[model samples]
Target: MAHLLSVNAGRGRPADYTDAALTGIDKRPVAGPVAVAAPGGPTGTAGSGVAGDVIGDLRDHGGDDQAVYAYAREDLDLWQAELGRELSNGVFGENLTTSGLDVNGALIGERWRIGADLVLEVTSARIPCRTFAGWLAERGWVRRFTQVARPGAYLRVIEPGRIEAGDRVEVVLRPEHDVTVEVLFRALTTQAELLPRTLAAGEALNVLSAERIRRRLERMNGVPS
Candidate 1:
């Protein structure tokens, strides 16, 4: 059974220091089986509960999905190859580290029931940001990350519940379209032309991504700048 290898959380002003400090946050045991809920549901309050909603709150602040991260079981080695020297705590800043799951391939609007308490839906991929570049101390780390691991994903809770380490995570739903996290990531960052097409496909993209695609279509059609 696929389970959460670990779970992490933190709160801080966005900046270079924040990324460095996230290294020390402690990971604890999730009670077991958490539930995910829709945005604005009782369990989805931005400041309350297990910080999933808190991340959603940050999104409200205009923070893009880059503020969060998810990593696949297989790519853990790749991350180590890139940033192993900087990872003294032996954990990445990702809020969730999962095993036996390929999150990048999960469809948007798809639901993942973690353990029994928490439910997470694949909403979007975490686009690399300058903060990540600062963490890597590389000028092009953001582009490099996009080109390399394609990372894991960003999620929103569909139900609220306690999530701790070692909880089992299973896919409750998958997207009907073939668009994957890697596809979306590539479309959004490297291949600008595909943005509209990927958006048109609209199989697994989160709300923000969908909006971005719509905007691209508008621009391509010369409706507005």
Candidate 2:
């Protein structure tokens, strides 16, 4: 049974990049009821487009689609075996941490509703970038992440609502398409054979990140990369 394992949010004071170069920001648990938006809906302070747009941009910047951040449930042992180190208490920067969710295996376009308020659409998986690499305080943390756990999905809010720790999350839709987050991640990063299918799924989501993937796939096939 899938369960909400833990919920975390950035509590570290917003980094004043101009004032000082902050190497890493710490994440802590937060009260629930996070924000969400719809297509052509109001985008929050992040200044993208809609809520999905925000998620799409984040994906471009290396964030996962639904499982934006994740922490293992079997204590720190899983992290040690997978991440090569124990997750320090309150370390993994994730908005909602869950258990029993094979988030990586979750099909793209799946939806999960939380607490009757927030509706999350599984979009894609975490693609490590410089920010994540810096977060781990290692030069090759991104490569290590890809080689190790493969992390989870990043979610776009389908409806606006408050989410809190301990809220029950129910899967609303399981994708019928073969495209999964892992497949999309590989399509975007490694030039997989299923890249065309992954791009088609991304286009169905109508996300800019997906458009980028589609373009990349086209180029890779000698149609245009």
Candidate 3:
């Protein structure tokens, strides 16, 4: 059975490893329950996004589109074997580290019910950026991660409620689309040609993904974005 392994939250703080900006990437597992919900602000405050999860860079990082991020423990274990390092929960900056669930293979627009009432919809896959590369402190991390292309899924809060560690996770609803998060990662990172095919997922994609597909369409037809 799929279950929530941890509920992580962080605050904005200086990170020498990353660029000259405060980051909330060093998330730690919460001791008790934490609320999971959509943002109360237009862009979203630190606590408003998910009660305790902080968003340092709103312009590029946080918003309603990426309210929650989940990474599967199974996949983390695979990375652990490859990297020869013990990766703990929240080490990858994932909000909810899950077990047994196929986070990468999950279809976009899939609704997952956590705890009693917290519902999150799969929106997109987490993109590995400079911040992530720096936080990992690994050379060629972006390329290595992009090549591996198992980037976890980002979720949008659909129903607000409290959640905690060890909570059972259920797939409440799945859209009738075959486009999974892994497919999205491949299309966005490795294969530009697959971007146009993502239109099959329709509105399941977030604004950035939708725009990327549109630009791909334009480029294919020799039109300006």
Q: Relative to the true structure, how large is the alpha-carbon lDDT of every model?
A: 0.57, 0.56, 0.83
Give the residue spans of candidate 1 off by over 4 A.
13-49, 52-69, 83-92, 200-204
Tell me, by lDDT, which candidate is best.
3
lDDT tens digits, residue span 1-225, model 1: 777776655444344434332222232323444333333422122322344323323432223222234666556666667665534221444667777888777766667887666766666766765455554576577777878746567776666676666878888887676667777777777777767547534544556677777777687788886
- Write the number of the candidate with greater TM-score, choosing between 2 and 3: 3
User: On residues 53-97, what C-alpha lDDT tens digit does candidate 2 reach at each position?
Assistant: 222223243222333444445533565565576675336455566
**Tens digits of per-residue lDDT for model 3, 31-143:** 78898877744333323356777767765566777788899988889888988888898878899999989999999899999999999989888889878888888789899
RMSD of each: 4.9, 5.1, 1.8
What would the TM-scores of all predictions be? 0.74, 0.73, 0.94
The alpha-carbon lDDT assigned to residue 40 of candidate 3 equals 48
Give the clash total for candidate 2.
Answer: 15
Query: Could you arrange the candidates by lDDT from highest to lowest?
Result: 3, 1, 2
